[model samples]
Target chain A: MSFQISSQPIDLAVLRNALAHPHAGACATFEGWVRNHNDGRPVLSLEYEAYAGLAEKEGARILAEACAKFDLVAALAVHRTGHLQLGDLAVWVGVTAAHRDGAFGACRYIIDEAKARLPVWKKEHYADGVSAWLNCAIRGGFSTAAGPPSGPPTG
Target chain B: MKTVRIQYFALLREQRGVGQETLATAAATAGELYAELRSRHGFTLPADRLRVAINGEFAPWDASLTDGVELVFIPPVAGG
Candidate 1:
């Protein structure tokens, strides 16, 4: 399992190849992109920041937890920091397993956990010439019972 | 009294007008330290809206303070 934070654009092909294994028959991947709008407001761009030390540690732990909770061969995730234009990839998760269920389950688990647990923040630059730091409020509270990201991530 | 290094991020960093600082403090735990700094810095966020980290690890608000520690007050995060 590997978790990394990159300031540059993520290379998806590299990540996909890294998860290749002879025993793995299934692969699942997720990509979070910067959308053109959010909360009914137009978004021109986004900036991401991270407390690298804790983020990497927590992110890796999330991947490890997903591997344990599901049968998997490998799990990897990358989160990008710095300025990102609309449609740019903000985060990516990939998993490989012997079966489709394990791969898909672990992939979802990793992204959800990483969003809630990692010490990273996102700032949205709106077309209205205002930029604000997004919080759990937009998502209607932290880590809902239905499976959204939670606070502190240690839980 | 103990001296600790503190780092801020996002809103806190912008509000504090600096990313990091070092200070000697009389507070005994992370919670007290945040209260103290909140007053001194006029930070707008409440204790309940934040989390604490000591030496690059997530720590409880009531975690005890120690000399020469690196501390961070994490705001609500939105990653993914």
Candidate 2:
């Protein structure tokens, strides 16, 4: 499978090795890390949860689409689940192509589509002791930007 | 009645207090099943805010439910 859900810390070198291709001349990668702050709140940590079965299916579909659209030699994406501390790598996307354009374009497509379509959720534990699930806001309640949630406030 | 395995994730799991369950239900469509469970479990998010998946693929909320199928109610995804 081109896409996978990893519960452990992702090994970047291994992922890069998988994308190596004899005919490819360019490699593009994107790594999403657990940031320390969001919407001004000091995020202490993040928890990612996924419906593993469906997530893998959808994630693979996304990679396939990226390959077709960008004419990539290979594309691979891995998303990390469970608790992650600040600065930890949360998601990684790598693509190889004969030229830079395809590699870059496909890499961008995979990460963007994965974020918008993958069957995953993120919960942010703030420094102030409040924790809330991100991106569960009702329509028209919150902007399209991944901002603060509108759900019942909890600590 | 059909027996379906319904799985919950993230917020729905937290509200339902379980990851999944196999249940017999009279609801014919995915939407109907969600309505019944939402009331039973006091789900905060409504049908409009969620998407339903059947047998590991994203299915329309109004799609018919089949016996022995797996159903999931997906919340707004935040993956990166």
Q: What DockQ do you compute for every candidate structure?
A: 0.57, 0.61
lDDT of 1 by residue, A58-119 (tens): 99899889989998999999999999998789999999999999999999899878877788
Worst 10 residues of 1 chain A by lDDT: A146-155
Interface RMSD of each: 5.9, 5.8
Q: What TM-score is obtained by chain A of candidate 2? A: 0.88
Going through the candidates in order, the fraction of native interface contacts each one reproduces equals 0.73, 0.81
Task: Put down candidate 2 lDDT per residue, A78-149, tens digits, no spaces.
Answer: 898999988888998999999999998998888878887889899999999998788764455543434434
DockQ, candidate no. 2: 0.61
RMSD of each: 4.4, 3.9
Candidate 1, B7-31: lDDT as tens digits: 9998889889999999999999999
Q: Quote the RMSD, in angstroms, for model 2.
A: 3.9
TM-score of chain B of each: 0.96, 0.97
